[model samples]
Target: MRIALLSYSTKPRGGVVHTLALAEALAALGEDVTVWTLGRGGDEGFFRAVDPAVHLRIVPFPDGPQNEGVGPRIIRSIAVLRDAFDPVAAKYDIVHAQDCISANAVLPSGRCIRTVHHLDQFTTPELAACHERAIVEPDAHVCVSRSVADELARGWGIKAEVIPNGVAYERFADTDPAARRAWKQRLGHYILTVGGIEPRKGSLDLLEAYALLRTKHPDPALVIAGGETLFDYRDYRARWEARAQELGVQPIVLGPVPDDDLPPLVAAADAFAFPSVKEGFGLAAMEALAAGTPLVVRDLPVLREVFADAARFAATPATLAEQLSAALTAADPRRQTAGRRLAAQHTWTEAARRHLDFYRRAGQR
Candidate 1:
């Protein structure tokens, strides 16, 4: 099968990560897979090196004029991506889009499949339109979690197939002890969170929770890593910094960890924190599970659906702190074992087979 997978940016966002991994998995099945993406911020390639089996097409997209609003930038992004993606419709059997921007770009071309990772309410007019169109226009839709698929059905009256994300189980589960020790030496005992300090990530809430957590466990540090984003979060970040100062909490912020360094870093953490306000599959937390790290995630349906009894959950900052403290101090062995088992169950190879089956079904339609 000739499959063309499209993503908005070559960044380290969840959807982009899914696109790269899925493409490689499909290629491993002896299928012809090509990944199409916009190379924002002068990126020559994806954040990490992609497998040689999968073909890559990174479209150059330079920065726009200074002070360009998010709306204009989004419109420009659509135009640029649409202009670059011109695959022969007859050649490719499936053109699957991974995000709203990519879905919008491909919708007009006919019969594109979209994976709705999660539903978001965009304030920007252009982004709002793009999001709605992407949801409504795709020929078929898939969601990583049943909760998100239910949301799609409730809001748009559209039934979407549910196909959960696959994790790089062995990569994290088999992290070298020496490498993990190296990270432990560098960062000390810490509670770690990936995906950066953004609003949707519940950054401010985490700061509040960390502050409370410090009262009980002052020794462990709060470390944040991997925050590469397309939208401007300067205002939200400023507020977060101010609140951190007010709460007298100093968090160690490592901008973006290299691909090779990530597994050990995850393995070294005393506990992993995932307090996102929204999520599809909680992939990062799953990876933390693969590393045998105790996890404390936000109490959301999607997260509950994904993690189940494998993770500790919290709703508010106070509860979040309480949960983090418990996970850090004395994590349950049963939960740790369960988490590892859950992560190991979700393999890229299995996900690839399911995707191929979905493609065949979509083709029949």
Candidate 2:
């Protein structure tokens, strides 16, 4: 089988990560897989290295002039990617798009499969249009969680196949002790969250929670890691900064942690915080579980569906703070063991087999 997996950017966003991982997994199954993505800002490769077996096509997407409106930029993005991708569409047995932008780029041909990682309520007119078309135009749909699949059904009477995300369990579970020790030495005892400060990530809420948490545990620091994104969040970031100052919370903001050092950073953390307002699957939190780190995630339907009892949940900042404090002080070894087992059960090989099954079925349809 030949597959072309499409994603919008080469950044460290969840969907891009999924695209690369799934491509490698599919290649391991003796399938011809090529990953396609826009090389935004001259990025010649992915945030991390990919398996040599999978082919890559990074289309050049240069940044537009300063003060370009979001709407025009989005339209231009679709145009550039679509023009770059159309010539290569016929080479693959399956052209699966991983996000709205990539899905939109492929939709003109009307012969693409799309993975709806999650549904979002977009207020911008262009984004709203892109989101809707991506959902409705794809020949077949895939979702990472049943919660998101259900959202598609409720919103548009669309039925999507559910395939859970696979975690790189051993990479995190067997982190180098020296690397872990080095991170611990640098950051000290801390709580960590990836994905940066954005509105959707509940950055302000986490800040509030961190402030409350400091009342009891002032020694353990709050560290934010990976944060490379395409969206504009300056207003939200400014608000977060103001709140942090008001709360007297000084978090160690290590933006875009090096890919090689991420596992050890996750491993060394006292607990991992995933207080996102929305999510398809809590991939970072799952990686933390793989590393035997206690995790606290927001109480969302998707998270509840994915995590169940393997993690602690909170709805509000105060409750989030409470959960973090408890997770820091009294993490149960039994839960940690269960988490490790759960992470082990979700392997890329299993995910790949299921994806192949889906591709065959969708092709027949």
Candidate 3:
């Protein structure tokens, strides 16, 4: 079957990563798959190289006005993508959208599938409308975790297919020793978190936790990486800076690291912290596990459902500090082994087969 997977941007966000990975896996299963995304900031390709078998259609979405607000930007984004995609929408056997904006862009066709990675409560009028329409209008839905699918059922009486994310286990598990040494040499012992400093990422909470961790153990510094996003969080960022200063903590914020360097950086970390307020799946935390690194994440239902006993859970900053501290010092070979085993089992091939099964069932309907 011919499939077109749509995502809003070519950035390193979770949904975009899922789109690319699933496309390649589907192609490997002898299906015709084409990945469609906006070439934001003139990005001609994805963050990492994709399999040559999958086709790509990077619709050039140039930046909007200098003073454009998030609402206007989102509206313009939908218009541009719709203009580029709607004309060709009829040819594909399946058009699956990965986010609200892409789902909205394909809304006119009334024949698209959606992957609701997670549900968010948006207050902005336009964004709230987009989010609601994206959820209600799709012909079918897929979610990365059972908790999220449960939310859809409770909120809208919608049932969705549950397809867990597949991790690139060997990419991180078999990272170059020299590359790991280089990150260790540069950053020393550090508690690393990906997805940058944002409200959803719980950046301020992590800062507070880091400060608390420093009171006893000052050996591990806080290193944050990967913050490329479409939303403007300058106000939140300013507040975070003030909190960091007030707590007497200075973290190394490496904005966006290269794709090739991510594995070694994760491998060299003392421990990985994922204190996000919301998440479909902790992809970065899973990568850390693939590298045999201890992980501490927020005590959310989705995380608990996905991670179980393979990771340490913390509900607040104080507990995050406590869990992070233990992760730094304590050595649980059983937990480490469990984490590696979990990461190894979630392969893209299995995810692809399940997706194909879902697609075929949908086609029959």
Model 1 lDDT-worst window of ten: 83-92
Instruction: Estimate the overall C-alpha local distance difference test score of candidate 1.
Output: 0.92
TM-score, candidate number 1:
0.98
lDDT of 2 at 136: 92
lDDT against the true structure, each candidate: 0.92, 0.91, 0.93
The residue-by-residue lDDT of candidate 3 on 282-357, one tens digit each, is 8889999999999999999999999999999999999999999999988989999999999999998999999999
**Candidate 2 on 99-195: residue-level lDDT in tens?**
9999899877558999998888988899889999999989999999999999999999999999999999999999999999999999999999999
Model 1: pairs clashing at backbone N, Cα or C within 3 Å:
none
What value does the lDDT take at residue 358 in candidate 2?
A: 96
Query: What tens digits encode model 1's per-residue C-alpha lDDT throughout 1-365?
Result: 99999998887888988999999999999999999899888888998999999999888998999999999999998888888775554568899999888888877777899999998999999999999999999899999999999999999999998899999999999999999999999989999999999999999999999999999999999999989988999999999999999999999999898999999999999999999999999999999999999999999999999999999999999999999988877749899999999999998888899999999999999
Model 2 TM-score relative to the real fold: 0.98
